[model samples]
Target: MTDHVDVLIVGAGLSGIGAAHHIQAALPERTYAILEARDAIGGTWDLFRYPGVRSDSDMHTLGYRFRPWTQAKAIADGPSILRYIRDTATEAGIDRHIRFGHRVVRAEWSSENARWTVEAVHDGKPVHLAASFLYVCSGYYRYDAGHTPHFPGIERFGGTLVHPQHWPADLDYTGKQVVVIGSGATAVTIVPAMADRAAHVTMLQRSPTYIASLPAEDPIANRLRRLVGVRRAYPITRWKNVALSTLIYQLSRRRPQVMKSMIRKGAVQQLPPGYDIDTHFTPRYQPWDQRLCVAPDGDLFTAIRNGRASVVTDHITEFSETGLRLESGAELEADIVITATGLRLLAFGGIQLTVDGRDITPPETMAYKGMMLSGVPNFAFTIGYTNASWTLKADLVSEYVVRLLRHLDTHGYDQCVPTNADPGLTEQPLLDFQAGYVLRSIDEFPKAGSRAPWRLGMSYAHDVLKLRYGRVDDGVLRCQRRPTRDAAIPAES
Candidate 1:
């Protein structure tokens, strides 16, 4: 079947839903549709079903800027988050516009046609659609698989081996020994959570990662909600959290030694009296060098103190019949092994892009405003901040897209392409983050520049000024009108 829309949005996750809300509210005349590959509303939330899964960042900044996060827990669980997403979809009537099971494989842009011809597969049948603009919100990581390195002798392990991305429903670990590998957000969350039912839970990491403790509920936010209404308190609390996070990130970057000392001191206060904090808690890199793992109210530490969970710092020589054998001549016994290693980075949802029959290579292009790509007309991809809440940058990108669409309508322009005219521009990695997933696949994504409108955003306040209020017709982005021999385009009311 063939379909046409003023805008075509990919992935009905947090960003896509938020984008639809902004576009529908501002430009009600513009027809839009969301193509979700999954059958559910919550993208990441629905995909991951591991025990004790929750948001690493607080919900205030992670939640939609337009919508108020009225929940008590600032660090919400997976089910709560999924419910929130579903509620948002239903409240906005955004679910009605979603085309589920539509896996978009390719998008072709035609200059003469002044639109994108999108090809997708739905229920094993080919589907065709056209749109004036394409907004990709499918996120950066691969949903189908998580990164699990080759563990020597993995086949010999008798117990169950699983990846957190695809957690099994029927699998039970009650009163069973569990060993989780890696020290990322997923591992920290799983270690404490599984400790309740497991005989013992151990987090085995090759090296240490920075793990910070945050309160599960924000006292200031709760008080404000009681004093004022939810809607009014939301923005205030959101900004407060944003400011606090920004300050931490900035301080960590500027004063690495001071921040590291502070973090170590905090860990010393939480763990046992004579615990080996140096071996298990100390990271070689500076704070925020890689993304810091969040531990709500020091639950991970509590689990360790109570002898429910423990941390092992060593390299895995190989997998044994019972568990993992470390290089330090130590063996860990386990009934279940959870590889919370990391995610595999995928570019543009692995969708092929062609412009006038010529393939568009992401690595060859430059990111414009960290959303739009250079020379890629009417195309934008939402990539959030690595240091802060993802939704912070995502909301900005959505607003920017809406503003750009409005500008196009105002000028009667058919195309707006961002061109990097500067010949002496220096190229850099799109994300400065040193996470294993990013390091493994950074070359597959677009490059960032050393200057403004080309460099990726790490600060929410800076993006607010740039994306929210900045001129849509910035010198870099060129707007043009071309004669199109096709059906009449919709006129502004």
Candidate 2:
């Protein structure tokens, strides 16, 4: 069956949900649909269920501005955040408009018709839908069959192997030796939580990572939240966390040695008496160089102090019958193994997009304000940087897209395409940071040349001002008139 809509939004996660809210609020008369690949609503939250899974940023900023975060502690866990997203979708009436089990595989833009033809699989059958505009909210390729890196002789290992992305609820870790591989946020979280229930937990990392610890609960903030509404308290709470986060980021950037010393001090306070912070906590790269791991309640550091957990700094040469054999000739035994090796991101629902039959190569395209891509008309994709909350930027982008759509509706135009004037522009990196996901996917993404709109800025303050209140005359967007034959052609008065 074929369906038609004014706008087709892909993915029902934070970004997609945000987009839907803005579009419906701004244009109540216009009809739109959010196509979700999965049966559930929360995208990443629904996908990752590993122990200690949670947001790295504070909830005040991570949550939507329209819906203030009411939680006392700014940092939140997976279940709470998931509930927030699901609740937001329900309250916004977004759930009624979604078509689940519909995995979009491709989208082709027709210049002749000035519409997008999207193809998806529903119930093992292909379905086509057309829309005047398309909005992509599918996050970076973080989910796809959880990544399980193969160590030599892994199949021969006697222990159970799992990836954090696909962690099982029934799997028991009580009194078992658990070894988690990878040093990102997921690994750091798993170590602490597992150490509580397991016989022992060991985190194996080839290199150290910059980890900062904080209390699980904030008392004064909680008091203020109770005294005032969350909306009233949200700004202060968000800024407070932002200020602290920013100060540490700047300290790490300017005074590397000082930041290193401070981090080591925290580690020393929470680790064993003779524990060497330099060997396990001192990262070779600058702090925030890669995303810094955050541990609330100081769980990771607590495990180390209590000697319930330990860190191994060496490459895995192979997997033995019951454990891993390190490249340094040391073998560590474990009853269970988890590969938190990270995620592989897919762009545009892993679908191949084309304009009038010509394929659009995402890596070769230019991202304008980190949202709109050159030559793509009335389309925007939400992608957040390693520094801030993913939802904050997504919410702002949603507002901007809605505004752009409103402008087009009033202007008697059916199309607003962002075409790079200089087709000969060479490709360059979007972000120069050392984030593992960004690093691995950089070569496969659209490059921002040295120019406005085309360049991607990681700063939230800059983007919020530019995107939320910026002008449309920027060289990137090209507003065009509707064709004479279209059904919505403006009346010639």
Candidate 3:
């Protein structure tokens, strides 16, 4: 017999926990359970254990709206974030509702029963469960493997090679030369962190990424907390961060040159005067074309200034026995090399979906409001903003889902599916970001329309208006109730 639930949430991470909280608060009567693939909570935070693993976005906005972050540091480390998540679950009694090691592999929807039959693996056995609605919080990338490009002669490298995604617990780099490949957030973070112990660290990149230095602690936030208290200051700080992030993003798009100059100037202020800013600090792409890499308290630049680390901008020709050899005839000798390449994006947790015996291909389908897929009934997924704090959008998605579920119950509807009504609407890529991870897997995900509702504006203000307060009975959504036995029988007439 299949165990049934009102809502079956896949993944017990940040988004999943938040979703559960909203459901419990808004629709307490509904029965729901979270299925986590891993044995622990904190999803990304728990998985990543590399040196200096900290959030790129500030905690004020990254933290859930319901629970305000009281920590002193706005940019928190992995352990702190993990503690925050676990504490929230424990306090809310949400820990009991999670089923660990249940990795959902397939989901089938039946129109007749108005339910989703989900199949997962647990302890090397198949487990079956049913739910009226399926909430996917599994996130956008695959956990099993990260995206690693094939480097010629990589097998010849004699030293330790590591990827930040799966950092080994027993690995040690103390008093050794370390070369971190790529200029993404992870690379920038690990360079400074590993520099503390490693004799020297070098960041090798083909092209540069926009790097910004933000204070670890916000003076304004601290002052506000002292005056108005943590609870009262949270919203104020969150709004301030959101507004600032939004303004910078908008300006980067509108006035690229001005923003580029400002970013360049900031980088120069942090580094030594003779440092090669053009070679190591400048990016060919416009600001925000790819997500900007943030260094708390300019740690990366400080390491460079102190001669503990340095940056080399050159393409890797091949990997020699010692380390990487560049196309410019320069070779970096290292005892350890770390690949901070990127992630492999996974849609719907790589779960197979079928509707009424028809296989649903994600790329062929359209994403409705960046949450639900067109023609997918009683289902919603969370994908956060690329330009701002992820939780800013995730919170809105959770609230919207709760509102939608309540609407269905109140109206006696068994199923509510968003159908793409406009056939003439042109399809656009759902994620507009040019990050390598996104670009590599964008085609595997669903498409969004070029117009409203179907198109995700990626703007928090616009989403607030459309998702939070938007009508549930909009014509684009088709709501239906299963026919009762008596109603199914033809009228006597």
Tell me the TM-score of each prediction against the true structure. 0.97, 0.95, 0.98
Query: How well is each residue in 284-320 modelled by candidate 2, as lDDT tens digits?
Result: 8988888888889788888887889999999999998
Per-residue lDDT over 1-493 for candidate 3, one digit per residue giving the tens place of the 0 to 100 score: 2389999999989999999999998889889999999999989999999999999999999999999998789999999999999998999988999999999999999987889999999998999999999999999999989878999999999999999999999989999999999899999899999999999999999899999999999888899999999899999999999889999999999999999999889988999987789988889999998999999999999999999999999999999999989999999999999999999999989999999899899999999889999988989999999999888888999999998988887877888888887868999999998999999999999998988788876788888888899898888878877545235642220
Clashes (candidate 3):
0
**Alpha carbon lDDT at 259, candidate 2:** 89
Candidate 3 differs from the real structure by a C-alpha RMSD in angstroms, to one decimal, of 2.3
lDDT of each: 0.92, 0.83, 0.91
Write down the RMSD of all candidates, one decimal each: 2.5, 2.6, 2.3
| Model 3 stretches with alpha carbons more than 4 Å out | 483-493
Compare the candidates by lDDT and give the number of the best one.
Answer: 1
| Candidate 1 lDDT by residue in tens digits, 1-493 | 2389999999998888888888888889999999999999989989999999999999999999988999899999999988988899899888999999999999999988889999999999989999999999999999999999999999999999999999999989999999999999999999999999999999999999988888999999999999998999999999999999988999999999988998999899899999999999999999999998889999999999999999999999999999999999999999999999999999999999998889999999999999999988899999999999999999999899989998888878888889999888899999998899999999999999988889998999999999999998878998777546323753221
